[model samples]
Target: MEKPNSSNALVCELINKGTREWNINNLNSWFLPEDREAILGIPLSSSNTPDRLVWAETRSGKFTVKSAYALALEEKVHNTRADCSDESAGKIWKTIWQLRIPQKIKHFASKAARDILATKSNLAKRKITPNGMCDLYVVKMRKQSVICYGAVIMPKKFGRIAGSGVVIRDDAGEVFAALSKKWKSPLGAIEAEAKALEAGVNFAREVGIREAEFESDSVVICNALQGLVSPPSSVVNVLAGIMNEVSYFRQWKFAHVKRQGNVPAHLLAQHAKNVEDFVAWRADCPSLIEHACMQDKM
Candidate 1:
Protein backbone atom coordinates (compact mmCIF):
# COMPACT_ATOMS: atom_id res chain seq x y z
CA MET A 1 0.00 0.00 0.00
CA GLU A 2 1.07 3.62 -0.53
CA LYS A 3 2.75 5.24 2.47
CA PRO A 4 0.56 7.34 4.75
CA ASN A 5 0.86 11.13 4.90
CA SER A 6 3.84 12.81 6.56
CA SER A 7 1.80 13.13 9.75
CA ASN A 8 1.66 9.33 9.84
CA ALA A 9 5.27 8.77 8.78
CA LEU A 10 5.89 6.59 11.82
CA VAL A 11 3.23 4.16 10.62
CA CYS A 12 4.90 4.07 7.22
CA GLU A 13 8.25 3.25 8.82
CA LEU A 14 6.59 0.48 10.78
CA ILE A 15 5.04 -0.96 7.63
CA ASN A 16 8.39 -0.83 5.80
CA LYS A 17 10.19 -2.49 8.71
CA GLY A 18 7.58 -5.27 8.67
CA THR A 19 8.37 -5.89 5.01
CA ARG A 20 11.82 -7.24 6.07
CA GLU A 21 13.41 -3.78 6.23
CA TRP A 22 13.64 -3.31 2.46
CA ASN A 23 17.26 -3.26 1.20
CA ILE A 24 18.57 -0.48 -1.07
CA ASN A 25 18.78 -2.65 -4.25
CA ASN A 26 15.06 -3.59 -4.28
CA LEU A 27 13.73 -1.42 -1.43
CA ASN A 28 14.53 1.84 -3.27
CA SER A 29 11.89 0.81 -5.80
CA TRP A 30 9.24 0.63 -3.00
CA PHE A 31 9.85 4.31 -2.12
CA LEU A 32 9.99 7.37 -4.37
CA PRO A 33 13.36 9.11 -4.30
CA GLU A 34 11.82 12.13 -2.57
CA ASP A 35 10.29 9.88 0.17
CA ARG A 36 13.63 8.18 0.67
CA GLU A 37 15.28 11.60 1.00
CA ALA A 38 12.59 12.72 3.48
CA ILE A 39 12.94 9.61 5.65
CA LEU A 40 16.72 9.00 5.54
CA GLY A 41 17.85 12.54 4.57
CA ILE A 42 19.80 11.04 1.64
CA PRO A 43 19.55 8.85 -1.44
CA LEU A 44 19.67 5.11 -0.87
CA SER A 45 23.09 3.50 -1.45
CA SER A 46 24.14 -0.05 -2.36
CA SER A 47 25.83 -0.57 1.04
CA ASN A 48 22.79 0.42 3.15
CA THR A 49 21.46 -2.64 5.06
CA PRO A 50 18.20 -3.62 6.86
CA ASP A 51 19.88 -3.46 10.30
CA ARG A 52 21.09 0.13 9.75
CA LEU A 53 17.66 1.46 8.91
CA VAL A 54 15.72 -0.76 11.35
CA TRP A 55 17.49 0.68 14.44
CA ALA A 56 17.64 4.30 13.28
CA GLU A 57 16.24 7.04 15.53
CA THR A 58 14.62 10.33 14.55
CA ARG A 59 15.08 13.80 16.06
CA SER A 60 11.49 13.54 17.33
CA GLY A 61 12.52 10.68 19.68
CA LYS A 62 10.67 8.06 17.62
CA PHE A 63 12.15 4.79 16.37
CA THR A 64 12.50 5.76 12.69
CA VAL A 65 12.48 2.16 11.42
CA LYS A 66 10.60 0.29 14.16
CA SER A 67 7.79 -2.18 13.17
CA ALA A 68 5.30 0.11 14.94
CA TYR A 69 2.42 -0.53 12.52
CA ALA A 70 2.92 -4.28 12.65
CA LEU A 71 3.02 -4.21 16.45
CA ALA A 72 -0.04 -1.98 16.64
CA LEU A 73 -1.99 -4.31 14.37
CA GLU A 74 -1.02 -7.28 16.53
CA GLU A 75 -2.05 -5.42 19.66
CA LYS A 76 -5.44 -4.61 18.14
CA VAL A 77 -6.01 -8.25 17.19
CA HIS A 78 -5.10 -9.44 20.71
CA ASN A 79 -7.34 -6.87 22.37
CA THR A 80 -10.28 -7.79 20.14
CA ARG A 81 -9.84 -11.48 20.93
CA ALA A 82 -9.58 -10.82 24.67
CA ASP A 83 -12.63 -8.56 24.61
CA CYS A 84 -14.72 -11.18 22.78
CA SER A 85 -13.97 -13.91 25.33
CA ASP A 86 -16.15 -14.12 28.43
CA GLU A 87 -15.41 -15.58 31.90
CA SER A 88 -12.40 -17.62 30.83
CA ALA A 89 -10.50 -14.67 29.42
CA GLY A 90 -11.70 -12.45 32.26
CA LYS A 91 -10.37 -14.90 34.81
CA ILE A 92 -7.12 -15.17 32.92
CA TRP A 93 -6.78 -11.42 32.74
CA LYS A 94 -7.67 -11.17 36.43
CA THR A 95 -5.02 -13.76 37.29
CA ILE A 96 -2.48 -11.87 35.20
CA TRP A 97 -3.42 -8.63 36.96
CA GLN A 98 -3.16 -10.35 40.36
CA LEU A 99 0.38 -11.29 39.47
CA ARG A 100 1.25 -7.81 38.13
CA ILE A 101 -0.69 -5.27 40.24
CA PRO A 102 -1.42 -4.78 43.94
CA GLN A 103 -4.54 -6.74 44.87
CA LYS A 104 -6.11 -3.86 46.86
CA ILE A 105 -5.75 -1.40 43.96
CA LYS A 106 -7.08 -3.86 41.37
CA HIS A 107 -10.39 -4.29 43.23
CA PHE A 108 -10.76 -0.57 43.82
CA ALA A 109 -10.17 0.25 40.16
CA SER A 110 -12.62 -2.44 39.05
CA LYS A 111 -15.30 -1.12 41.42
CA ALA A 112 -14.84 2.42 40.10
CA ALA A 113 -15.39 1.26 36.52
CA ARG A 114 -18.56 -0.59 37.61
CA ASP A 115 -19.86 2.52 39.41
CA ILE A 116 -19.29 4.63 36.27
CA LEU A 117 -21.22 2.15 34.15
CA ALA A 118 -24.11 2.12 36.63
CA THR A 119 -24.33 5.90 36.67
CA LYS A 120 -24.26 6.09 32.87
CA SER A 121 -27.06 3.53 32.54
CA ASN A 122 -29.19 5.20 35.19
CA LEU A 123 -28.89 8.54 33.37
CA ALA A 124 -30.81 7.08 30.42
CA LYS A 125 -34.12 8.01 31.96
CA ARG A 126 -35.60 10.48 34.43
CA LYS A 127 -38.63 9.94 36.67
CA ILE A 128 -41.30 12.61 37.07
CA THR A 129 -43.84 12.22 39.86
CA PRO A 130 -46.62 14.75 40.32
CA ASN A 131 -47.93 14.13 43.81
CA GLY A 132 -51.06 16.00 44.85
CA MET A 133 -49.17 17.51 47.80
CA CYS A 134 -47.77 20.12 45.40
CA ASP A 135 -49.92 22.22 43.15
CA LEU A 136 -49.26 23.49 39.61
CA TYR A 137 -49.02 27.26 39.01
CA VAL A 138 -49.69 29.21 35.83
CA VAL A 139 -50.15 32.85 34.91
CA LYS A 140 -51.18 35.01 31.97
CA MET A 141 -49.11 37.91 30.74
CA ARG A 142 -49.33 40.62 28.09
CA LYS A 143 -46.19 42.78 28.03
CA GLN A 144 -44.71 41.97 31.46
CA SER A 145 -41.07 40.94 31.69
CA VAL A 146 -42.06 38.03 33.91
CA ILE A 147 -44.23 36.19 31.41
CA CYS A 148 -46.22 32.91 31.49
CA TYR A 149 -45.42 31.12 34.78
CA GLY A 150 -46.07 27.64 36.22
CA ALA A 151 -44.98 25.44 39.16
CA VAL A 152 -46.03 22.65 41.57
CA ILE A 153 -45.25 22.59 45.25
CA MET A 154 -46.38 21.23 48.64
CA PRO A 155 -46.74 24.30 50.89
CA LYS A 156 -47.30 22.45 54.22
CA LYS A 157 -44.32 20.15 53.66
CA PHE A 158 -41.69 22.86 53.02
CA GLY A 159 -42.12 26.04 55.02
CA ARG A 160 -40.35 28.24 52.49
CA ILE A 161 -39.56 26.79 49.12
CA ALA A 162 -37.59 29.97 48.78
CA GLY A 163 -39.54 32.96 52.53
CA SER A 164 -41.85 35.56 53.72
CA GLY A 165 -43.75 37.22 50.86
CA VAL A 166 -43.99 40.92 50.01
CA VAL A 167 -46.74 43.07 51.52
CA ILE A 168 -48.69 45.50 49.27
CA ARG A 169 -50.80 48.07 51.00
CA ASP A 170 -52.96 51.12 50.39
CA ASP A 171 -53.05 54.11 52.77
CA ALA A 172 -53.81 51.67 55.61
CA GLY A 173 -52.82 48.02 56.22
CA GLU A 174 -56.55 47.15 56.26
CA VAL A 175 -56.76 47.89 52.55
CA PHE A 176 -53.94 45.85 51.01
CA ALA A 177 -53.01 43.23 48.35
CA ALA A 178 -50.92 40.01 48.48
CA LEU A 179 -49.70 37.82 45.61
CA SER A 180 -47.41 34.77 45.27
CA LYS A 181 -46.54 32.21 42.51
CA LYS A 182 -45.09 28.66 42.80
CA TRP A 183 -44.17 25.87 40.41
CA LYS A 184 -42.62 22.33 40.00
CA SER A 185 -39.18 22.80 38.46
CA PRO A 186 -37.50 25.13 40.96
CA LEU A 187 -35.28 26.82 38.36
CA GLY A 188 -38.00 27.64 35.83
CA ALA A 189 -40.80 27.92 38.41
CA ILE A 190 -39.86 31.30 39.86
CA GLU A 191 -39.47 33.00 36.48
CA ALA A 192 -42.88 31.84 35.29
CA GLU A 193 -44.41 32.76 38.61
CA ALA A 194 -42.76 36.17 38.56
CA LYS A 195 -43.99 36.78 35.03
CA ALA A 196 -47.50 35.83 36.09
CA LEU A 197 -47.25 38.17 39.05
CA GLU A 198 -46.03 41.01 36.83
CA ALA A 199 -48.90 40.40 34.44
CA GLY A 200 -51.38 40.35 37.31
CA VAL A 201 -49.91 43.55 38.72
CA ASN A 202 -49.96 45.19 35.26
CA PHE A 203 -53.53 44.08 34.69
CA ALA A 204 -54.41 45.40 38.11
CA ARG A 205 -52.70 48.67 37.27
CA GLU A 206 -54.58 48.96 33.94
CA VAL A 207 -57.90 48.38 35.76
CA GLY A 208 -56.82 50.68 38.59
CA ILE A 209 -56.79 47.78 41.08
CA ARG A 210 -54.94 49.43 43.96
CA GLU A 211 -55.89 47.00 46.71
CA ALA A 212 -56.36 43.25 46.08
CA GLU A 213 -55.31 39.72 47.07
CA PHE A 214 -52.82 37.84 44.86
CA GLU A 215 -51.25 34.56 46.03
CA SER A 216 -49.00 31.90 44.46
CA ASP A 217 -48.59 28.28 45.44
CA SER A 218 -44.82 28.67 44.91
CA VAL A 219 -43.29 29.54 48.29
CA VAL A 220 -39.86 29.49 46.68
CA ILE A 221 -41.05 32.12 44.23
CA CYS A 222 -42.36 34.21 47.12
CA ASN A 223 -39.05 33.82 48.89
CA ALA A 224 -37.20 34.98 45.81
CA LEU A 225 -39.47 38.02 45.43
CA GLN A 226 -39.06 39.02 49.10
CA GLY A 227 -35.25 38.67 48.87
CA LEU A 228 -35.35 35.58 51.09
CA VAL A 229 -33.72 33.25 48.55
CA SER A 230 -30.77 33.84 46.28
CA PRO A 231 -31.37 35.02 42.76
CA PRO A 232 -32.96 32.34 40.56
CA SER A 233 -30.88 30.63 37.89
CA SER A 234 -32.98 30.32 34.71
CA VAL A 235 -34.37 33.83 34.32
CA VAL A 236 -32.45 35.96 36.81
CA ASN A 237 -31.87 39.02 34.60
CA VAL A 238 -35.46 39.08 33.35
CA LEU A 239 -37.00 38.61 36.80
CA ALA A 240 -34.64 41.23 38.24
CA GLY A 241 -35.79 43.73 35.62
CA ILE A 242 -39.43 42.84 36.32
CA MET A 243 -38.84 43.37 40.06
CA ASN A 244 -37.26 46.76 39.35
CA GLU A 245 -40.18 47.83 37.14
CA VAL A 246 -42.77 46.70 39.68
CA SER A 247 -41.22 48.89 42.40
CA TYR A 248 -43.99 51.43 41.85
CA PHE A 249 -46.60 48.76 42.49
CA ARG A 250 -45.66 48.76 46.17
CA GLN A 251 -49.21 47.86 47.14
CA TRP A 252 -48.66 44.16 46.28
CA LYS A 253 -48.25 41.19 48.59
CA PHE A 254 -46.86 37.71 47.97
CA ALA A 255 -48.49 34.83 49.81
CA HIS A 256 -48.13 31.00 49.69
CA VAL A 257 -51.11 28.70 49.15
CA LYS A 258 -51.59 24.94 49.43
CA ARG A 259 -51.74 22.92 46.21
CA GLN A 260 -55.31 21.82 46.92
CA GLY A 261 -56.37 25.45 46.99
CA ASN A 262 -54.33 26.44 43.90
CA VAL A 263 -56.36 24.58 41.29
CA PRO A 264 -56.80 27.72 39.22
CA ALA A 265 -53.04 28.19 38.89
CA HIS A 266 -52.58 24.50 38.15
CA LEU A 267 -55.18 24.73 35.38
CA LEU A 268 -53.27 27.67 34.03
CA ALA A 269 -50.08 25.61 33.98
CA GLN A 270 -51.89 22.86 32.10
CA HIS A 271 -53.17 25.57 29.83
CA ALA A 272 -49.61 26.88 29.32
CA LYS A 273 -48.51 23.40 28.27
CA ASN A 274 -51.35 23.28 25.73
CA VAL A 275 -53.41 21.00 27.90
CA GLU A 276 -56.47 23.07 27.06
CA ASP A 277 -56.96 23.87 23.40
CA PHE A 278 -59.22 26.82 24.10
CA VAL A 279 -59.06 29.55 26.76
CA ALA A 280 -62.46 30.44 28.16
CA TRP A 281 -64.33 30.42 31.41
CA ARG A 282 -66.76 27.54 31.82
CA ALA A 283 -68.33 26.34 35.03
CA ASP A 284 -67.50 22.69 34.26
CA CYS A 285 -64.78 23.04 31.57
CA PRO A 286 -67.06 21.11 29.23
CA SER A 287 -64.29 20.28 26.70
CA LEU A 288 -62.08 18.76 29.41
CA ILE A 289 -65.05 17.06 31.03
CA GLU A 290 -66.10 15.66 27.66
CA HIS A 291 -62.52 14.38 26.94
CA ALA A 292 -62.50 12.65 30.32
CA CYS A 293 -65.88 11.09 29.59
CA MET A 294 -64.54 9.74 26.26
CA GLN A 295 -61.44 8.27 27.90
CA ASP A 296 -63.65 6.48 30.44
CA LYS A 297 -65.70 4.94 27.65
CA MET A 298 -62.51 3.60 26.00
Candidate 2:
Protein backbone atom coordinates (compact mmCIF):
# COMPACT_ATOMS: atom_id res chain seq x y z
CA MET A 1 0.00 0.00 0.00
CA GLU A 2 1.13 3.59 -0.67
CA LYS A 3 2.26 5.41 2.52
CA PRO A 4 -0.15 8.21 3.64
CA ASN A 5 1.41 11.70 3.71
CA SER A 6 1.11 14.75 6.00
CA SER A 7 -2.52 15.29 4.94
CA ASN A 8 -3.50 12.09 6.67
CA ALA A 9 -0.87 11.88 9.43
CA LEU A 10 -3.20 10.12 11.91
CA VAL A 11 -4.01 7.46 9.35
CA CYS A 12 -0.26 7.18 8.44
CA GLU A 13 0.61 6.55 12.14
CA LEU A 14 -1.97 3.82 12.42
CA ILE A 15 -0.79 2.24 9.18
CA ASN A 16 2.88 2.29 10.38
CA LYS A 17 1.87 0.57 13.62
CA GLY A 18 0.95 -2.65 11.71
CA THR A 19 -2.71 -1.65 11.81
CA ARG A 20 -3.26 -1.54 8.04
CA GLU A 21 -6.41 -3.61 8.24
CA TRP A 22 -9.19 -1.10 9.00
CA ASN A 23 -12.77 -1.20 10.26
CA ILE A 24 -15.32 1.50 11.35
CA ASN A 25 -14.63 0.89 15.07
CA ASN A 26 -10.83 1.22 14.61
CA LEU A 27 -11.06 4.33 12.40
CA ASN A 28 -13.79 6.15 14.35
CA SER A 29 -11.38 7.91 16.78
CA TRP A 30 -8.97 9.12 14.04
CA PHE A 31 -11.41 10.00 11.23
CA LEU A 32 -14.79 11.66 10.78
CA PRO A 33 -17.58 9.19 10.03
CA GLU A 34 -18.06 10.61 6.49
CA ASP A 35 -14.28 10.53 5.82
CA ARG A 36 -14.06 6.96 7.00
CA GLU A 37 -16.98 6.02 4.77
CA ALA A 38 -15.20 7.62 1.75
CA ILE A 39 -11.98 5.77 2.54
CA LEU A 40 -13.77 2.48 2.85
CA GLY A 41 -15.59 3.02 -0.44
CA ILE A 42 -12.31 3.16 -2.47
CA PRO A 43 -11.37 -0.22 -3.99
CA LEU A 44 -8.00 -1.53 -2.98
CA SER A 45 -5.56 -2.00 -5.90
CA SER A 46 -3.22 -4.98 -6.28
CA SER A 47 -0.48 -2.70 -7.78
CA ASN A 48 1.40 -0.33 -5.39
CA THR A 49 1.31 3.38 -6.23
CA PRO A 50 2.37 6.64 -4.50
CA ASP A 51 -0.36 8.90 -3.01
CA ARG A 52 -0.87 12.17 -4.96
CA LEU A 53 -2.99 15.30 -4.55
CA VAL A 54 -6.18 15.23 -6.64
CA TRP A 55 -8.14 18.23 -7.88
CA ALA A 56 -11.81 17.25 -7.78
CA GLU A 57 -12.69 20.07 -10.21
CA THR A 58 -11.11 18.19 -13.17
CA ARG A 59 -11.46 14.60 -14.28
CA SER A 60 -7.65 14.44 -14.75
CA GLY A 61 -7.02 15.52 -11.12
CA LYS A 62 -4.73 18.45 -12.20
CA PHE A 63 -5.06 22.22 -11.71
CA THR A 64 -5.29 24.73 -14.54
CA VAL A 65 -5.06 28.54 -14.43
CA LYS A 66 -8.44 28.86 -16.10
CA SER A 67 -10.21 26.72 -13.50
CA ALA A 68 -8.48 28.56 -10.65
CA TYR A 69 -9.57 31.93 -12.01
CA ALA A 70 -13.17 30.73 -12.37
CA LEU A 71 -13.23 29.48 -8.80
CA ALA A 72 -11.85 32.77 -7.52
CA LEU A 73 -14.50 34.72 -9.40
CA GLU A 74 -17.25 32.51 -8.00
CA GLU A 75 -16.03 33.11 -4.44
CA LYS A 76 -15.87 36.85 -5.05
CA VAL A 77 -19.41 37.00 -6.39
CA HIS A 78 -20.70 35.06 -3.42
CA ASN A 79 -19.06 37.51 -0.98
CA THR A 80 -20.20 40.81 -2.57
CA ARG A 81 -23.98 40.97 -2.24
CA ALA A 82 -24.84 44.66 -1.99
CA ASP A 83 -23.92 45.56 -5.60
CA CYS A 84 -25.15 42.34 -7.21
CA SER A 85 -28.87 42.87 -6.71
CA ASP A 86 -29.23 46.61 -7.28
CA GLU A 87 -31.78 47.10 -10.12
CA SER A 88 -32.28 50.86 -10.14
CA ALA A 89 -28.58 51.55 -10.01
CA GLY A 90 -28.07 49.74 -13.32
CA LYS A 91 -31.02 51.51 -14.92
CA ILE A 92 -29.73 54.94 -13.93
CA TRP A 93 -26.34 54.15 -15.43
CA LYS A 94 -27.87 52.95 -18.66
CA THR A 95 -29.99 56.10 -18.93
CA ILE A 96 -26.98 58.32 -18.47
CA TRP A 97 -25.07 56.48 -21.15
CA GLN A 98 -27.94 57.00 -23.58
CA LEU A 99 -28.13 60.78 -23.13
CA ARG A 100 -27.24 62.96 -26.17
CA ILE A 101 -24.76 65.16 -24.27
CA PRO A 102 -20.98 64.99 -24.57
CA GLN A 103 -19.47 61.88 -23.05
CA LYS A 104 -17.28 63.83 -20.61
CA ILE A 105 -20.23 65.87 -19.34
CA LYS A 106 -22.32 62.75 -18.96
CA HIS A 107 -19.53 61.11 -17.01
CA PHE A 108 -19.15 64.13 -14.72
CA ALA A 109 -22.89 64.41 -14.14
CA SER A 110 -23.22 60.72 -13.36
CA LYS A 111 -20.43 60.92 -10.79
CA ALA A 112 -21.94 64.06 -9.30
CA ALA A 113 -25.34 62.39 -8.98
CA ARG A 114 -23.79 59.53 -7.05
CA ASP A 115 -21.81 61.96 -4.84
CA ILE A 116 -18.69 60.04 -5.80
CA LEU A 117 -16.93 62.71 -7.85
CA ALA A 118 -13.89 64.52 -6.44
CA THR A 119 -15.88 67.52 -5.23
CA LYS A 120 -14.64 69.64 -2.37
CA SER A 121 -17.19 68.21 0.03
CA ASN A 122 -16.27 64.62 -0.85
CA LEU A 123 -12.54 65.38 -0.58
CA ALA A 124 -13.00 67.03 2.81
CA LYS A 125 -14.78 63.91 4.05
CA ARG A 126 -11.71 61.84 3.15
CA LYS A 127 -9.46 64.20 5.17
CA ILE A 128 -7.87 65.70 2.05
CA THR A 129 -7.46 69.36 1.20
CA PRO A 130 -9.80 70.54 -1.54
CA ASN A 131 -8.37 72.49 -4.48
CA GLY A 132 -11.13 75.08 -4.20
CA MET A 133 -11.47 75.32 -7.98
CA CYS A 134 -13.55 73.75 -10.70
CA ASP A 135 -12.06 73.06 -14.12
CA LEU A 136 -14.65 72.82 -16.90
CA TYR A 137 -13.61 72.20 -20.47
CA VAL A 138 -16.28 73.85 -22.57
CA VAL A 139 -16.43 73.01 -26.25
CA LYS A 140 -16.99 76.21 -28.16
CA MET A 141 -19.13 75.84 -31.24
CA ARG A 142 -19.78 78.44 -33.96
CA LYS A 143 -21.12 81.51 -32.20
CA GLN A 144 -24.72 81.11 -33.24
CA SER A 145 -27.06 83.75 -31.89
CA VAL A 146 -28.70 82.31 -28.77
CA ILE A 147 -31.77 83.38 -26.83
CA CYS A 148 -30.86 85.18 -23.59
CA TYR A 149 -32.96 85.70 -20.49
CA GLY A 150 -32.51 88.06 -17.52
CA ALA A 151 -34.38 88.94 -14.35
CA VAL A 152 -34.43 91.53 -11.56
CA ILE A 153 -36.41 92.35 -8.37
CA MET A 154 -37.33 95.70 -6.76
CA PRO A 155 -38.07 96.53 -3.12
CA LYS A 156 -40.86 98.74 -1.71
CA LYS A 157 -42.00 100.23 1.64
CA PHE A 158 -43.97 99.00 4.73
CA GLY A 159 -42.07 95.65 4.69
CA ARG A 160 -44.06 94.89 1.51
CA ILE A 161 -42.13 94.46 -1.71
CA ALA A 162 -43.16 94.46 -5.35
CA GLY A 163 -41.60 94.20 -8.80
CA SER A 164 -39.86 91.36 -10.62
CA GLY A 165 -38.79 91.43 -14.25
CA VAL A 166 -37.92 88.76 -16.82
CA VAL A 167 -36.53 89.66 -20.22
CA ILE A 168 -35.83 87.33 -23.16
CA ARG A 169 -34.06 88.52 -26.26
CA ASP A 170 -32.50 87.06 -29.36
CA ASP A 171 -28.96 87.68 -30.63
CA ALA A 172 -30.10 90.58 -32.87
CA GLY A 173 -31.11 92.54 -29.75
CA GLU A 174 -34.81 91.89 -30.36
CA VAL A 175 -36.85 91.23 -27.27
CA PHE A 176 -39.15 88.29 -27.98
CA ALA A 177 -40.54 88.08 -24.48
CA ALA A 178 -40.60 90.45 -21.49
CA LEU A 179 -42.32 90.11 -18.13
CA SER A 180 -43.00 92.36 -15.14
CA LYS A 181 -44.75 91.32 -11.97
CA LYS A 182 -45.38 92.59 -8.43
CA TRP A 183 -44.92 90.46 -5.31
CA LYS A 184 -46.68 90.86 -1.93
CA SER A 185 -43.67 90.13 0.28
CA PRO A 186 -40.12 91.46 0.42
CA LEU A 187 -37.08 89.35 -0.54
CA GLY A 188 -33.35 89.99 -0.21
CA ALA A 189 -31.49 90.99 -3.36
CA ILE A 190 -29.55 87.71 -3.59
CA GLU A 191 -32.64 85.60 -3.02
CA ALA A 192 -34.51 87.63 -5.60
CA GLU A 193 -31.65 87.17 -8.09
CA ALA A 194 -31.74 83.42 -7.66
CA LYS A 195 -35.51 83.35 -8.01
CA ALA A 196 -35.27 85.40 -11.19
CA LEU A 197 -32.75 83.02 -12.69
CA GLU A 198 -34.98 80.06 -11.95
CA ALA A 199 -38.02 81.78 -13.41
CA GLY A 200 -36.13 82.83 -16.57
CA VAL A 201 -34.82 79.32 -17.19
CA ASN A 202 -38.28 77.91 -16.74
CA PHE A 203 -39.70 80.44 -19.16
CA ALA A 204 -37.07 79.53 -21.76
CA ARG A 205 -37.96 75.87 -21.37
CA GLU A 206 -41.64 76.68 -21.70
CA VAL A 207 -40.98 78.60 -24.90
CA GLY A 208 -39.09 75.64 -26.45
CA ILE A 209 -35.62 77.18 -26.35
CA ARG A 210 -33.55 74.02 -26.11
CA GLU A 211 -30.12 75.66 -26.53
CA ALA A 212 -29.59 78.96 -24.78
CA GLU A 213 -27.38 81.11 -22.58
CA PHE A 214 -28.42 83.02 -19.48
CA GLU A 215 -26.68 86.09 -18.11
CA SER A 216 -26.85 87.58 -14.64
CA ASP A 217 -25.21 90.68 -13.19
CA SER A 218 -24.96 89.16 -9.75
CA VAL A 219 -21.38 87.86 -9.54
CA VAL A 220 -22.12 85.86 -6.41
CA ILE A 221 -24.91 83.81 -8.00
CA CYS A 222 -22.93 83.29 -11.20
CA ASN A 223 -19.85 82.16 -9.28
CA ALA A 224 -21.84 79.65 -7.29
CA LEU A 225 -23.23 78.09 -10.48
CA GLN A 226 -19.74 77.77 -11.93
CA GLY A 227 -18.56 75.97 -8.73
CA LEU A 228 -16.17 78.80 -7.83
CA VAL A 229 -17.74 79.36 -4.39
CA SER A 230 -20.14 77.54 -2.15
CA PRO A 231 -23.58 79.01 -1.65
CA PRO A 232 -24.88 79.67 1.85
CA SER A 233 -26.50 76.70 3.57
CA SER A 234 -29.79 78.58 3.41
CA VAL A 235 -29.61 78.63 -0.43
CA VAL A 236 -27.85 75.33 -1.09
CA ASN A 237 -31.11 73.57 -1.72
CA VAL A 238 -32.18 76.31 -4.10
CA LEU A 239 -28.93 76.03 -6.02
CA ALA A 240 -29.37 72.29 -6.28
CA GLY A 241 -32.86 72.77 -7.71
CA ILE A 242 -31.51 75.21 -10.29
CA MET A 243 -28.81 72.74 -11.28
CA ASN A 244 -31.47 70.07 -11.73
CA GLU A 245 -33.29 72.38 -14.13
CA VAL A 246 -30.07 73.08 -16.00
CA SER A 247 -29.60 69.38 -16.66
CA TYR A 248 -32.66 69.49 -18.90
CA PHE A 249 -30.91 71.69 -21.44
CA ARG A 250 -29.11 70.07 -24.35
CA GLN A 251 -26.61 72.96 -24.50
CA TRP A 252 -26.55 75.73 -21.96
CA LYS A 253 -24.14 78.04 -20.15
CA PHE A 254 -24.30 80.77 -17.51
CA ALA A 255 -22.42 84.02 -17.83
CA HIS A 256 -21.51 86.85 -15.47
CA VAL A 257 -21.39 90.31 -17.02
CA LYS A 258 -20.97 93.92 -15.84
CA ARG A 259 -24.18 95.61 -14.74
CA GLN A 260 -23.95 97.68 -17.94
CA GLY A 261 -24.44 94.56 -20.05
CA ASN A 262 -27.54 93.57 -18.07
CA VAL A 263 -29.33 96.88 -18.38
CA PRO A 264 -32.34 95.48 -20.21
CA ALA A 265 -33.20 93.04 -17.44
CA HIS A 266 -32.50 95.71 -14.85
CA LEU A 267 -34.74 98.19 -16.64
CA LEU A 268 -37.58 95.64 -16.89
CA ALA A 269 -37.17 94.86 -13.19
CA GLN A 270 -37.54 98.54 -12.41
CA HIS A 271 -40.56 98.71 -14.70
CA ALA A 272 -42.21 96.03 -12.55
CA LYS A 273 -42.22 98.32 -9.53
CA ASN A 274 -45.11 100.40 -10.88
CA VAL A 275 -47.20 97.46 -12.19
CA GLU A 276 -50.14 96.21 -10.11
CA ASP A 277 -50.05 92.54 -11.17
CA PHE A 278 -48.14 91.09 -14.11
CA VAL A 279 -47.55 91.97 -17.75
CA ALA A 280 -45.80 90.17 -20.62
CA TRP A 281 -44.97 91.04 -24.20
CA ARG A 282 -44.14 88.73 -27.12
CA ALA A 283 -43.00 89.02 -30.74
CA ASP A 284 -42.10 92.70 -30.19
CA CYS A 285 -39.64 94.68 -28.15
CA PRO A 286 -40.99 96.54 -25.15
CA SER A 287 -40.65 100.32 -25.81
CA LEU A 288 -39.20 100.73 -22.33
CA ILE A 289 -36.36 98.16 -22.76
CA GLU A 290 -35.64 98.43 -26.52
CA HIS A 291 -32.81 101.00 -26.14
CA ALA A 292 -31.34 99.07 -23.20
CA CYS A 293 -31.35 95.84 -25.20
CA MET A 294 -29.79 97.61 -28.19
CA GLN A 295 -27.01 98.95 -26.00
CA ASP A 296 -26.29 95.47 -24.66
CA LYS A 297 -26.10 94.08 -28.21
CA MET A 298 -23.66 96.86 -29.20
Using TM-score, give the best candidate's number: 2
After best superposition, candidate 2 residue 192: deviation in angstroms?
1.0
Model 1 poorest 10 in a row by lDDT: 123-132
Show where candidate 2 strays beyond 4 Å. 1-155
* Residue 71 in model 1: lDDT: 48
Candidate 1: count the clashes. 19
Supply the global lDDT for candidate 1.
Answer: 0.37
Residue-level lDDT tens digits of model 1 in 45-110: 111123222211222223533445644664575456546267886886577566764443454444
> Pairing residues by index, what is the TM-score of model 1?
0.31
lDDT of 2 by residue, 111-218 (tens): 445444544454344322224332222111101124333443332242234345677667665677777654433333455566566656766776667777877666
